[model samples]
Target: MRRAEYHCAAHHPRDWVEDTGAEVAFSGRSNVGKSSAVNAITGRKGLARTSKTPGRTQQIIFFNLDETRRLVDLPGYGYAKVPVQLQQHWEKTVRRYLEERVSLRALILPVDCRREPTVLDWQLLKWCAASQLPVHVLLTKSDKLGHGKSLQALRQTRESLATMPLVSVQLFSATRNVGVTEARERIVDLLSGQGNGRKPA
Candidate 1:
């Protein structure tokens, strides 16, 4: 995780660097803490810009994970306040990147634990499933719930993902430093060519 460093931000296909190495993408609805999780995973305080402002991440940012692998922070979706044209552009950019990137190894999806996955979340999951890509879902904001409630949320998420064999679910709280180590290990293993699609135990 120490080796993770900012690489570049790409707003368009022409601006994107050549996709030639293993990479994983962090994706979620606006304000779901993708930036916070990225910062927590890499132990970089200001790496991804934790912001209360929704839609702060307006482009796909790349970060190098060690020497040969990379991490991607994709723009969030499903927020309504943004202009229609801008939202359409985001949708197109994200879909194109996911469908065409050759070196993408996995997806890290974050969702609020207290609420059921929104329609947009389900849409994203379906896209990943269609692409035959593996995923790890972080039930963010788990610390805001009681232990029993958090466990229930995790269980619900896991059950919902039972049909998506290549996707795994886990309770995570960037605020409480929970599940960071496990998340790092899973990602590092994926980068190491372990494409077996192991489920969380």
Candidate 2:
């Protein structure tokens, strides 16, 4: 089997409707290294912009792959500097895309390995639950923690999210390329309708 080729297609707000057959949504806190992870998975540099400022991605960015699959980089939520009204708008927009977009296959939720789950993370998870969307938590920045600590963090996260059924979790570090291949393979499987060990419910 060969790897898929990914390229940035366009960036637009949630209201902008485009035809993307199958897509995977990347969701996480601000500056949690979501863009870097996408670039690492695709083996392409500068495909997704890295920003120091939280909530820099105020719109949904779509990367089309081989004219078949799409990788969506959603706007980061819970940034303090962004106005409350704008934040609410972003939340609504993102929620709409996740709940309403017919082509979305799954959501990859990234969380800082060193930090515990936050309120916003739980809120997003709840939204996914309500919409019956499959979510896999990617523990980002695992390189920042020791092996034992990383394992502990994963366990804690699993316990925290125990109520959500069929939630998959993995450790990832874009800089060291840890778990990049696994992530890519899983994404491909999901897009190809071979993932989740069963049909999507």
Candidate 3:
């Protein structure tokens, strides 16, 4: 539909946590194309700036939509250059938010199609499983793989994370618009409380 209304709601470091209602979080490894996916989904260039350095998004950035919805871009995990203390702080912050935030509706975990699930991904999934929060796996950059390889990758991912409860697993290519419509519709439906089908875990 219309490009969902968006605006910068708040920027919070590990200290100042601002509460937003019914927010959806985007989480992934460092430079796993989370920002690119955000820009693609919103159809706004630079809405979520792409960074050359991994772990550049060191703070939680919240983008408010129509003053009703919030799209949260969480700091990427497993970035090496950042200091250990900062990394620990981010981990704590993200974990606290995920566990405590009542307005959070879902967590969208983006994984690069070329890479297998990392330990960080497993940890995130484990946290979601413990919390019983809805999780979705978005296999980004699907065009990077051949058709057979892409399907294999998706299957492998599903198999590897068999224990985690995921809402859905979808092939997504922001560059090719492969699953953009379906992803968007699914997300919208979920946000509206319509798509309650428990997707394959």
Best by TM-score: 1
Q: Which digits, one per residue and each the tens of the lDDT, describe model 3 over residues 9-114?
A: 3334434335544667899999998888787777776788788789888778776665556678889998888899889888888877887776777788899988
Candidate 1 lDDT over 1-201, as tens digits, reads 876889899999888867777888999999999999999988887888778989989999999876668889999998889999999999999999999888888899999999999998998898888877888899999999999999999998999989997788888889999889888888887666575442221
Report the number of clashing residue pairs per model. Answer: 0, 0, 0
Write model 2 residue lDDT over 1-201, tens digit each, in one string: 123343443333424536457778899899998888888888876778888888887778877776667788888877899999889887878877876777888888899999987898988889888776778888999999999999999898888888988577889999888899988888888776565622432
Top model number, lDDT: 1
Estimate every model's Cα lDDT from 0 to 1: 0.87, 0.79, 0.76
Each candidate's TM vs. the true structure? 0.95, 0.88, 0.87
RMSD of 2: 2.8
Q: Which residue pairs show backbone clashes in model 2?
A: none
TM-score of 1: 0.95
TM-score of 2: 0.88
Which residue pairs in candidate 3 collide?
Answer: none
Cα lDDT, model 3, residue 179: 80
